[model samples]
Target: MCENAAVTSTDGQQSPPPAPVVPLTDAWLVIPLFNEAQVVRGVIEEARRVFPLVVAVDDGSRDDSAAQAAAGGAVVVRHPLNLGQGAALQTGITYVLERTDANFVVTFDADGQHSVADAAAMVQAARDEDLAFVLGSRFLQGPSPVGWLKRLVLKTAAVAASHTTGMHLTDAHNGLRVIRRDAAARLDLRQNRMAHASEIIRQLGATGLPWREFPVHIAYTDYSKGKGQSLWNSINILVDLLFS
Candidate 1:
C-alpha cells in the first residue's frame, strides 16, 4: 500500500517497473579468456556496465568459462582446442572487426588485473587526443607495486621492445590497450604465446600512427599474482623478442 509500491493488476497480481536502460559506449571490449571460471564472469559483468559490447574468446577452457561469460552478457566465442592467449586475442579482435561497427576496440585482461575505469579513461583519451592507440603504462605516475625482480624484468622488456620496435614504451607487456578501428585493423599477431605482447608493440609501431601511453594502476591481487608469468616464462619472452 506504499506510494512507491508495485501496482496491483486487475487479476490481483503485482507488476514492478521496468529496469532502467544503460546507454552503451561505442567501444567493444575484447577479452581473451582461458580457465578463469572464478573471475571472468564478474569481470565481464562489471565491464558491461560501462562498455556494453563485450566479446570473450574462450581458448578451450577446461571449466565453464564460456558459459559464465555468456551469462554475463558477453558474446562468447569458443576455441575447440586450447590455443594460446595471443590466438584468443586475435580471435576476439577479428570477431569485433568482422561483426561490429565499433569505432574502438579495447583489449582487456580476463583475470581482473586491469581496471574498467582505466579502460574508459584510455578510450576517452584516444577520442580527445585523436590518438590511434592508447597503451597502458604502470610506470608513468610512479613506481608500480611489483617486486624488484618483476619490475627489473618489465623494465628490461620495455627497453628491449623499444630498441627493436622504435617505439618508446614504459610498460610494453601491459595487457590493457585502447586501439582505434583503423589502427587495430593493421594488427597481425603471429606470436601465439607471451611473446605476442612484444609482437603487438612491433606491429603497432609499424603502423606509424599517433599513440601515447596512459598511466594505469594495476591491481596485483593474490589471484592475479598466482596467474602471473614466472621468471622462466619472462626469459623466454625476452628470447623470442631477441630472435624474432
Candidate 2:
C-alpha cells in the first residue's frame, strides 16, 4: 500500500507531493550498530521510508552512532559496553518483541550494505509463502563480486555450515534476514561475535520451519569497505565454527 499526500501553501500554491508512504507497518527493522556514526543515520532514514519501525541497538560505540540513529527516526537502544554484533542483535530483537506488536523482524546491517527494497521483498515473500524465516544469500543468483580470498572463505564456510546445520546455503554469513514474530522469539543467540552468523543458521535450521534464501545484493561502497570486518575476524569465525 502506498499513498502520496500534497499540501497547499497560504498563497494557494500547491506544494510538491511528498514521497509515497509504504505500508509495511507490521514489520520492524533491527539494526546492530557499533561505530557506524557516518552511515547508520542515512541507512535508518532510508529504510524508514518503507518500514516505519526501526530499532538500532548501539553496541557500546565510542562514537555518536546512537545519537545519529535516533535523529534518523529510529528508537536507539544503548549497551553500556561493547558486547559485539550478536549481542546487539539479540537486544534489538528482544526490544521489538517486548515493546512492539510487530509481526515480523528484519535484521539489517548498519553499514548501508543492505537494500531496503530487498528487505521488503523478503518480508513479502515470507508472508505470501507462510514461511517463518527468509535468509539472504549473495551467491543465490550467481557469483558475487567479492575478492578471491574472501569468496573462498565464504564458500568454505557455507559448505561447513550446511554440513553442520543440514541446510544447503550458498552464502552463510549474509546479515539480511526476515523472521516471523514466533520464529524470532525462538532465537537465542549466545555467540557474541561474528561466529553468531553460523550459529543463527544452525538454530534457525533446527526450528524445522519453512524457510528460503532470497538473492540480495550487498553494496561494497568505499565507506562500507573501510568498515568491513578484518581478516583476523574472518579467521576467528571460521575457527569458532569448526570447533563449536
Which candidate wins on lDDT? 2
Best TM-score among the predictions, by candidate number: 2
- Residue 50 lDDT, candidate 2, scale 0-100: 93
**C-alpha local distance difference test of each model:** 0.89, 0.90
TM-score of predicted structure 2: 0.89
Kindly give the stretch of ten consecutive residues in candidate 1 with the minimal lDDT sum: 17-26
lDDT of each residue in 1-244, candidate 1, tens digit only: 5545677899999899545544447899999998999998899988888889999999999999999999999999999999898899999999989999999999999988899989999998999999999999999997788777767778899998899888888989999999999999999888888889988998999999999999999887888677664455567766766676
How does candidate 1 fare on TM-score? 0.87
Alpha carbon lDDT at 12, candidate 1: 98
- RMSD (CA, angstroms), candidate 2: 5.6
**Colliding pairs, model 1:** none
